[model samples]
Target: MTTQEFWNKVKSPEYKVTQPRLAFADVLVQNQDVMLSAESLYEKTKTIFPKTNLSTIYRNLESLERLNMIYKVTTDDGLNLYKLKCASNEHHHHIICTKCGKVLDIHFCPFDTFSELAGKAGFTITEHRLELYGLCEDCRK
Candidate 1:
């Protein structure tokens, strides 16, 4: 999405969309497919807004996550990584490259069969999260 488009969405009643939040969103937009940690994002945002602090970065990130503008992925090492959420309206999952931290969205959802399985087991599903991790094509080489 363009910067203007992002800012328009940020105007929602759910968020205030301050300057620091815009800077944070810009960084994520520029690095769309790469997952970044809070520290890493702070470093990047510092280049744009030198006055911004780590706490501000964390706060903006939390707000963006709450707004569904970004998503979090925990690495195998237990570190949290984040990336811009895809703008599609469809339900999907993601595959992350363990080596390079590159992310690719998988449009097909396995839970499409949830209703069938749930019927057999007589269980009610509330919500779910599914993420796949492996080496990407470039990382495999």
Candidate 2:
């Protein structure tokens, strides 16, 4: 979506558009492959908007989340991370590292096969989140 369109979505739900919010969205929209924790995003956005604070980042994240423009991801470490939800993409899962908190994306929903198995077993599955925790290669080294 164009920046204008994205901001329009943000505006639709009584959300205020500000430089900090715009910058925060830009980071997620641009570096989409990397799911970032609040602290990581705040640290990077600060270079462009030096006055940006952690509180502001958190607020902007909440606003985006309210609009469903982004999704909240909780790492095993109990840290909250955010990823942009693009309408063009389908549902997916994430693979995150235990040692370094790195996140990797799985483009398709990982539960379809499990759904089949559960059906065979006469078990109904409504929702699920599969988080595999382990050391990433770099961390393992």
Candidate 3:
């Protein structure tokens, strides 16, 4: 999403987008890959807005997360990584490399067909998160 749209959504009564919120949204928009921890984001922000602190990043990250502008994933090593979300992007799941700790975005939603079958079988599926972990190509090399 564009910065203007993001800011507007945050400006809504329910969101109240502030300076920190704009900073967080701007960073997320730039971070296309490398899902980041709060600390990582703080490090990046320091270069642009040196006055920003880790606490500020942490607060904004959590607040934006609550607003569903981003989502989180806990890596196998127990670190929380975040990524931005948008209307056109589905971001179905990820394929994680256990060896080198890399994450690849997998846009295919395996449940779509299953959900159709489930509907025929009189079942309603609400949601799911499926992650497949293994050695990626570089890791295998």
What's the true lDDT of residue 141 in model 3? Answer: 83
Q: In what order do the candidates fall by lDDT, top score first?
A: 1, 2, 3
What does candidate 1's lDDT look like per residue over 1-141, in tens digits? 777777776677767767877787788888778888999999999899788899988887788778778878877789989887777878888898888778888988788599679968998777789989899999899
lDDT of 2 by residue, 2-73 (tens): 666677666764677678877776777665655678898898888778889999888888877878888666
**TM-score-based ranking:** 1, 2, 3
Best prediction by TM-score: 1
Q: How far is candidate 3 from the true structure (C-alpha RMSD, Å)?
A: 3.6
Model 1: C-alpha RMSD to truth?
A: 2.0
Show model 3 residue runs off by greater than 4 Å: 14-19, 89-91, 96-104, 112-124, 133-141
Clashes of 2: 0
Clashes of 1: 0
Provide C-alpha RMSD values for all models, in order: 2.0, 3.2, 3.6
TM-score of 3: 0.70
lDDT of 3 by residue, 33-111 (tens): 4467788788877777767888888877777777777767787679987776534565577776666545677878888
Q: Candidates 2 and 3: which is better by lDDT?
A: 2
